[model samples]
Target: MHFHGTEVRQQALTLLRGGSENAEVARRLNVPLGTISYWKHVDRAKRGEPVATRPSLLCPLCHRRPLDDSAYAYLLGLYLGDGHISHYAKHHVPSLAITLDDGWPGIQDQAETALRAVFPHNATCRVRTKGAHNIKVYFKHLPCLFPQHGPGKKHDRKIALEPWQQEIVDAHPWDFVRGLIHSDGCRITNWTTRLVRGERKRYEYPRYFFTNKSDDIRELFTDTLDKLGITWTHCTRNGNPFNISVARKASVALMDTHIGPKY
Candidate 1:
């Protein structure tokens, strides 16, 4: 929800300096209008071009204290997998919420840890909804945390990382992958039967599988795998919902080393 990255600040400055109106720039960039106005004031002050009162540009989460790269990357993956950002028109409040099955207390704890790491100033609360627990972070700039947000299911919309987000994910690929797997993937032992010289044999092996309806999300998962030298395959069951499987023994071992089994 906070804009801490230098890249995002630079982009806002460029757009404002190019004569884009504040509201239009904010709409186009999906940033809060206050954020764009704050940057514009900063630019004018720097150029001695002058004017109104100087409002503080410091964001509590982003400026006073910032999230570490690892935490941010993990949270990003979790959001992409099972999170959503909501804006209420009446109250004009934006919140980032990650929903997890109520059964997985460990996963809920991990998500809480990541959220707390990002917003130490704010308390992370868990609300029960239906059969899931929702971890919510209320902030004005929630969209900044998830620039890929749009209307409807993720698969029906395009998902792409901003430059700053890409840098964060690139630096902490393992953590990102761990978050993705923790949210939507699993490590399990699969068994199959084979006939060997008129005898039947059963063997068990460990493999990892991740399923997501979004093509872009799937691609992001596989791209991270490729970067980490992990091998994976695209698979389909029945007719819908794509999956990626890391079934090769060596690859599975490598993933185990990095992601292990979720606690």
Candidate 2:
């Protein structure tokens, strides 16, 4: 009597609790000799059950799982490419192995505990359900993605730019200079909406990119430095717009403050 996948799984589990030996379970269930062994661990548990049923595994950031480390690293690359952390957690699920929100309180607790280890000091860390047997933990800021404290102040600071002010900079004579201070460099200069009292607070993120070779780039860099704003810089060698000098400036901007608005 050949058993199907579902029957084999049930019999193997029954054998586990019934104290049946692997061979005995195989013989009694009339499955392959290695069937029990294979199915025994096929499922990775999010809580108490196995993870194989879902088939698709994804990370908490992107709603896809890696078939291998190469795939995982590819997802991480997308994360570095301007992917918002909150959006990642909100959308992605890790490996489908078992998310924190699998409706298993114990599993959710375990996942939360793991995240807490990474974000020991972050109070806003929490988990949400992604899909069947999938859960993702949400972390708001990019700098807080990893467990350890990042480069600068915890608080995300903002620069007040008038609507026309950014345009004026965008029209700068030098292409390099324009690139440096243009809207491209400033990702979040404007707010989604105005911040009013007794309502939710708004955060603004502004970044600048520069290269060292061009005179205009250098001038833009220096001018940005004089303004004392949050920025990250990368060089041709690094391939990031915010290079070492810009990082130093960015670090300075975040000094002496925790992230987010002060209560």
Candidate 3:
């Protein structure tokens, strides 16, 4: 008798548990109906749960599985900066979506790559809008990876990472910083003419600015910067410290090394 691999079986179980009908799951996964039914039976028996089953093996939060270090770190930063985890009515699985500027196709590719790396079994896609692209993927366990998903907007709620997430960011700090910079931050050069010994010379300043409304999110960004030995300051916007600026030459050099521009 031919049998599906364990990964395929686990994927089928997840789809079946996510309110998908037997025939739909079978068709979507290209698995035989009889095999799908058998997998469901075994999963139900093992879990001792009703129709709705627990998260499949892909959920690191539920299964204590190890995540792709660089991918998770980068995705976490993007999530806190500009990404959103959308909730829906019952029976509809949640989605993790990160909005990227269309001008930077490279960043879009990176976001898609990170999504695929994080959820190798799930499908990733991109939706184009007026001036940007939303790279998203549907997964029932998105909330398991990003615990910060909540009822209100990210800026309106407190954003904090779980211990395990923090560990990944600590390990791959550069990737995390790159994600944040590519999302809500930017690198620009400001030039001013200065008087030299003979003729006027143009003086230029290169700096990075990360803007986010949530205090907790800003703190998280700064905390990561401190660990990386990067200096930053609170750049006041509308009379409030809403933007984190890394303008020091040494720190800016370090940031340029890891994350130049959005491109």
Candidate 4:
């Protein structure tokens, strides 16, 4: 929660020494911007740089991770699919929110758990809006979890993984795939009517489908599948959003083993 006086000062100093901007430090620590400015001014004076003369008292100082695998990978996948990172100019806060169907409490719990795993310091809260529930994590910056964030729709923007992110994905591709499918994809049994020996017969089969508007995101899904040796088919639907279908029994079995059916 809340940091005070000496603790705040120490944390601010640590961040400042690490070359974090004053505004960033202020936002991250939830301290007043002016406080960071004052600390910076004091530091400058000690460094023999140009500084305004202010009351300098020897006030006591005090003290103060990423989603990579498992829960983190799952969270990342959920974010890439249903979560959104937004910046509020008025409050100067950057927040990440993931909305899930309130009807499914288990899914909401999973989302909250994943968010907590990825951002242990931040508080994860659930809010109900209309018929849906949202699990939100707020912080000072967006890059902490959503490095792929940029201007415009995710589909319209380019999405690429950093080397570290790639490494995580490479190590836990199954979890990553599970997250993606749990958020944006679905597994269902479909029934078809066919003629067998001149008689009408109904057959049922299982299939998994993932849909998104971003080509890059679609590629990421398929590429991950390729690495896992799972078969999938990509096709454009309505000449806008695209979809990937995993219908073969073996592929479906593999996905079931890794991702399973989202509850």
Candidate 5:
């Protein structure tokens, strides 16, 4: 009566979704027919259940496939910022969910687009909730791709990238920055009044702010900024160092050209 619970369930789910009959799934996975039925019942979520996917091709680590590093890097930043990877004790498969504000449909589109680009073999779907669209995908290799996936909130633990992931970020720094900004950062105008030759004038300048509770995440942001020759400062409010501001004129100009306000 004992079968590989996790692996068998995953294969069974794939087979069932791929148009295989229950008997066939039980045979292929060497699982009992009644167990397969029970599994299917539990497998479905409220909305948009995922179809079968060949993880070998979809997974960069499991097979020798060409992965879209640029998209991966961008998605990584978003994941570190506002994304969550969840798992159930019984289910082996892990789900990657990125919470994006519904206000900006364009950014949500880009997020889903990037997700599909990286895992072209898998089906990506979005679920709408109050004022936000949760972009999500299911895959076995998600943890392999985003090694930062672990128990507890990211800010509660250390967050660092693997060497290979770092290479991707280094190659596509702007994309990474844009992803972080899109998720946890914003660009706003700051105005001030100055006296110019006995005349009062108002000056407005655009500045970008990236706020995250994780210290390691903020450090990664500043390190990348250094590589891009972008000037940034650590902003503290009420004795907490959790905000990074790109307010310098030249840096803000660079941010405008590359990572403008998310529309």
Candidate 6:
């Protein structure tokens, strides 16, 4: 459903002022996330409105919010390290910078005090306390850097589609504006008996998509993508699904060759 121009601007402004998740809000509003961000920022500037902070991240005592990425990064680093770094900073790193030669005992106390003030008191602080060397090793060598910082935590986790899903998305015709490939239409065939191995029987689901227009969708897609600063390409034989299937091009392409752009 297309939105009226004024309605679109109003929704965008609400999302911007509220710091709502752009993608979810856009999906809910049936507008592209890029368009939402663009209109939100633009409308705010046009109104000479002061950008406001989402209250969730503000310090309870001061009501101050993070002003820069570095500050957020520092908070994230600290959160990842848990109270371990803070503990070490308080008890061991007596000569550490910031808190002077005595270390950050007061700062550590204030942070803990600040956290309890913000989060539920029943939620215990379970930050693992360890020496600096061990903490450093964990961050550098761990496959998942911010393991505990998931979708529910104070940070937003990156959502990555599975390899096959990525392949389908990559293979999607680029010129289309508002088309969607079906979630469950894809299928994969045999060649697997002697080609690959697992301990026992293998069961899997590989998917394909429905047929749709290319260029018209591409115009809409391009408009949204330009606003969002994204770029994409037509699928090539090198794409994972293309490599797996017997067909050189996507089956969807076969159904409607006119829908796709030249690679």
- Collision count of model 3: 0
> Which consecutive 10 residues in model 6 have the weakest lDDT in total?
93-102
lDDT of 1 by residue, 9-91 (tens): 78888988888899988888788998889888878988999657422222434544355779888988899899998888964
Count of residue pairs whose backbone atoms collide, per candidate:
0, 24, 0, 1, 0, 7
lDDT of 5: 0.88
Worst 10 residues of 5 by lDDT: 45-54
Better of 4 and 5 by TM-score: 5
Which is the leading candidate under lDDT?
A: 5
Give the per-residue lDDT digits (tens) of candidate 5, residues 57-124: 36687776689989988999899998998886564778889999988888999999999999887788
Candidate 5 is scored at a TM of 0.78
Query: Model 3, stretches more than 4 Å misplaced?
Result: 1-57, 198-200, 237-240
lDDT score, candidate 2, position 201: 77
Residue 3 CA error for candidate 1 (Å)? 33
TM-score of model 4 (CA atoms)? 0.72
**Candidate 1: regions farther than 4 A off:** 1-65, 89-91
Model 2 is weakest, by summed lDDT over 10 consecutive residues, at 74-83
- All candidates' lDDT scores? 0.83, 0.38, 0.86, 0.78, 0.88, 0.35
Better candidate number, 2 or 4, judged by TM-score:
4
TM-score, one value per model: 0.74, 0.18, 0.78, 0.72, 0.78, 0.18
Residue-level lDDT of model 6, residues 30-118, one tens digit each, is 88877877676667777897756434324322453332322222222233323122224333311111111113243344333433332
